[model samples]
Target: MVRRAGHLFAFLVVASTANAQMPPPTVGVIQLEAQAVPRSLVEPGRAMASAEVDIRPRVAGVVTEILYQAGRPVEAGDVLFRIEPSTYEADVRAAEADLAAARAAVKEAEAAVVRSERLLGTGTSQSTLDTARSTLEQARATLQSAEVARDLAQIDLERTSITSPITGIPGFAAVSVGDLVAANQADALATVTQLDPIDVEIWAPSARVLSLIEDISLDRVELAESITATLTLETGRAFEARGSMVATSQSVSETTGSRAARFRFENPRHILLPGMFVRADIVLGTANAILVPQSATEREPDGELTAWVVAEGRAVLRSLQEIGTHAHGWIVTEGVAAGELLAVDGLASLTPGLEVRTVPVELDEYGVVHDLRDAVAAGNVEAE
Candidate 1:
C-alpha cells in the first residue's frame, strides 16, 4: 500500500510539470470595428389588396342566376349575379303608362284652357277659366311626378343585373341561385379584391417612429430616397420584387405603442394574396454600428450571451446585448465596443484571465475569417 501511494504522488507531480511547461493555446481573433452598417426596421406584416369591394344587391329580388364563376377574375361592369327582373320590368311598364296618361291629361287641360280663353266673357264664365288654369297646373305637376317615377323604375330594372363596380377577382358567391336577397343586404353576394399593386401593411414600434421623425427633422436622412422594403414570405423564401413606402399613420396607437405603415408592391402576376403573412425589411438608412462574428458568441448556462475577447494579453468574457444580424454577423447594441479583439477560434480552452496567443484575422463579406498568417492581408487587425 505504501509503495502504491508513493507511485501515485510521483505520477501527479510529473503531470503537473508537463502541464506547466505547455505554452498558452493559440487563438484566432478579429478586431471588431464600427462600420457604416445599413440600418433597417424589420417587422411582421400582412398583405392586403389595394382595393376591395363587397358586391351587394341594390334591388330586392330572387337571384335568377350566378353570372360569374367563384374565385375568378372579373372586370368593372361585368355582371356577377342576376336578380329576377320580372317585378322591376312590370313596375317600369306601369310607370310608363302613368307617364303617358299624365301627358294626355296635360294636353287635355291645356286645350281646355285655350278653349275657355276663346270663350272669355261669353258662354264660358271667368270662374270656369280659373278652374281650367288650376287644373292645367295640377296636370303639369302630375307629369313631373310621373317622370320621376319612370326614371326610378328604369334604374331599379338596370340594377337587377348586379355588376362588379371595380376590376378585380371575385370571391365565392354568398348566395346561390333562387335565393331571395334584400336591397342593400348586410351580407355581400361576393367580394372582389384588386390584386395588382397590393398594399403591405407594416406595424413598427412607436419609439422607432419617433426616431425616424427626428432623423428627418434634422435632415440626417431623406425617407423618400433611403426608405425601401423587401418581403419574406411565411415559407422563408424572399419575394423577388421590391416595395416602396406609401405612408405612415398620423398617430401611434396608445395600446400597442406602434404606428401603422404601408408599402406598395407591384404584383403583376397576383402572386401575393390578401391576408398573407410576411416579414417586411424596411431599410431606413446606413449608420455606424459595432459588429461581431456570430461564431465568437456563446450563451452561458445562466442564459446570458457572451463573447470572448482579448484584453491586456488575456482572454476576457464580454456580455453582449445583440440587436440583430447584419452582413452575416451579429450587430451588438451593447457590451463589446468598437476595436475590441474578439476570439473567433480555439475557444475550448478559453477561460477568464487565461493568457492567449492571438493570430490576427480578417473577415470577408460573409463574415468568414481567414488567419492573416496563411492568407493575403486585407487589413491590419491589431489588439485593442
Candidate 2:
C-alpha cells in the first residue's frame, strides 16, 4: 500500500510538470475593423510654373530705359522697357511728310485730269487726256504706298516700348540700358513666370495605376467626381493649398514604366517654386478595406504574404490580398474580415493550430504596438 501511494505521488508530480511546461504562448493581438479609407497614391513630383513666358524684343533699337524693376510683378500690357524711339519717331515723320506730298500731287493730278476731260474734244488731244489720267493714277498709287509706310512706321514706334505679354513676375533683365536688341531675338530679354496658379508633375508607377483601374471597375473604389491632390515638401512640411488633377499621359514611359500626371494648385502666396521637389498624395477615392499591421505579416518563399490571425482560440495563418500600403500597414482587400483578431506580436512563435493566449493591443500612428492595459494606464485610451 505504501509503494502504491509513492508511485501515485510521482505520477501526479510528473503530470503537473508537463502541464506547466505546455501552457499556451501569450500574443498581442489587435482587432481589425473595416472602415472607409482614402485610396491614395504617393509619388515624387516637381513643381513647375503654369505659364512661363520669355520676354523678347519685337522691334530693333537700343534700350533707352528699364521701365520695370527686376523680380517684380507685372501686369499684361505694362511697359517693361523703352527702346530708343528717336529713329522710329524720325521715320514716322518722314513717312507722314511723304504721304502729305503724295496727297498734294494726287490732288494736282486729279485737277489736271478734270481739265483734260473738260477740253478733250476742243484743245486737249485724246493722247493728252490719257496722259493726265495715267499721271493721276500713278499719284494715287504713290499716296497709297505712303499711307502703308506711315502705318508701319507708327507700329514700329509703338513696339519700341516693350510691354509684358502676361501677368507674372519678371526675372532679371538680360539686357541693360544702352544695349542693342533686335526683333524676335533668340536670347530672351527676361522671363516672366505665372505664380498665382502652379503645376506639379507626378510620375506614378504603371502597376499602381492598373490596380486602381481594376479596383474602379470592380466597384471596390468609389471614384470622386473631382480627384484631389496634396503635397509634402522636401522639408517634410505639408503644402497649405490643395490641388486637382489636370492632365495625364496616355502612354507609360518605357524607361521608368510610369505615367506622368499633372496637377494644378492655387499658389497665391507663391510658396511653390518651379523645379522644387515634392511628394504628392493623389486621393482617387475612398473604399471600405482592412488594414493589417505590417509587423503582423510575413512573406513566404512563394512570394505570398501571410499573417497570423486568431480564430477560435488558435492561430490560423491567412493569405492576404493586399492592394497597397497606407499609413503604417498593408491595405488588404480580401482574406480578412472585420472583428478578427490579428496577432501583432509573437508572430515568430505562432504556428498553425497552436493555442494562443491573446491580449488586446493597439497600434499607434507609427505602427508600434502597445498593450491595452498599459495604454489605458498611460491615458492613451479610455478604460472600458
Candidate 3:
C-alpha cells in the first residue's frame, strides 16, 4: 500500500510541472499604421432661416382678401393680401381731375398773357401785361403741384396690394378679411422665412478652436480648402444634404465660452426648419493619425483609457492619449506608434508582461474583430 501511495504522489508532481510549462494564451492583434484621415469635430447646432421678413400693410384700409395660403411659399413681389382699394382708387381719380383742371387753367392764363402782349402797344397797358404774366406763372405752379399730387395718389393706390419683399414661406395671416389694418402698423400681417439654403449655427469650444489653429500652424494637420459639414437630426437619422462653413463669429460668447460657426446647407425638401436642434459633424481637415479600434481599449477606474500592445511576444498595457474618435476607432496621439501590434480580442485575460501569441486580425466595418485568415478565405477582406 505504501509503494502505491508513493507512485501516485510522483505522478501528481509531474502533472503540476507540465501544467506550469503550458504555452502562453493566444490573442488576436491588428497592426497600427499612421495614415491621413479626416479630422472631424461634432457639436450641437440649431437651424436658422437665412432671411426673415415681416409682412405688413403699407396703406391703411380694411382687409378685402387674403391672397396667399398660410405656410405656402411666396416669391418677391407676390401679393399676400388685398386692402380695400375703392377708397384709394377714388382718391387717384380725384387727383387726376384736379390735374386736368390745373392744366386747363394754365392754358387759359397763357392765352390771356398772349392777348395782353399783342394789345400792349395799343389799348392794353404795360401793367396789364405784367399782371397777365404773373397770373400765368401762378397757374403753372398750380399745375406742377397738381401733378405731384397725382403721383402721390397713384403710389397710395399701389400700396393697397400688400406684396412680399422677399421670397420665402409665409406664416399664418394675422389679419383676416374685414379686419382693419393701419399703414405701417406695429402688428405684422405675417412673417415670411427663407428655408432653402438654410443656416446652421454650430457652437464649438474656444479652446478646441485654438488647438485646431495650433495644429495647422505646426503642419500636423492639413486644413481642407473648404470645410464641409454633415448633420444628424434629432430623430437619429442622417441628413442627406452636405453643407459648407459660411461665416464664423469673431468673438466667443461670454456665457457659453464658445464661438459660433454658421454652415449653409440646401434644404430643398424643407426638412430643416428654423430653431430645429441637430448634431453637426464638421470636417476641418485631414491629419496623419494612428487609429486604434475601440474594442481594444478598456477604461480604467481612474477614467483613463488603456489598451494591450504586443511587444517582444508579451502583452504590454499602455495608457493611450486619445484625441478624438474616427470611424469605429479612436484617434490616438500618444502612447503607441506605427507598426505596433494592438490586441483586439481576449483582452480580459491579459496582464502586464504576460507572454502572448499574436494572431493577425482585422476589424470589420462595424469594428468587430475577425481572424485575418478566415476573413481572407471568405473574400471579406484582402490579404495584407
Per-residue C-alpha lDDT of model 2 across residues 30-102, encoded as one tens digit per residue: 8899988788999999999999999888899899998888777999999999999999999999999999999
Distance from true location, Cα of 173 in model 2, Å:
1.6
TM-score ranking, high to low = 2, 3, 1
lDDT of 2 at 361: 81
Runs of candidate 2 with Cα error greater than 4 angstroms are: 1-23, 98-147, 374-384
For model 1, how does the per-residue alpha-carbon lDDT over 84-182 read when each residue is reduced to its tens digit? 999999999999999999999999999999999999998999999999999999999999999999999999999999999988899998989999999
Candidate 3 weakest lDDT stretch, 10 residues = 375-384
TM-score of 2: 0.82
State TM-scores per candidate.
0.70, 0.82, 0.82
The residue-by-residue lDDT of candidate 3 on 1-384, one tens digit each, is 999999999999999999999988888888899988788899999999999999888899999989999888999999999999999999999999999999999999999999999999799999999999999999999999999999999999999998999988999998789999999999999999999989999999999999889878877678999999999999999999999999999999999999999999999999999999999999998888899888889889998999999999999999997767788888887889999989998887899999998777878999987777676678876533
Instruction: Name the lDDT value of residue 152 in candidate 1.
Output: 100
The lDDT of each candidate is 0.86, 0.91, 0.92
**Which 10-residue window in model 2 sums to the lowest lDDT?**
375-384
In model 1, how large is the Cα lDDT of residue 367?
A: 67
RMSD of each: 5.5, 4.6, 4.2
Q: Name every residue pair that clashes in candidate 3.
A: none
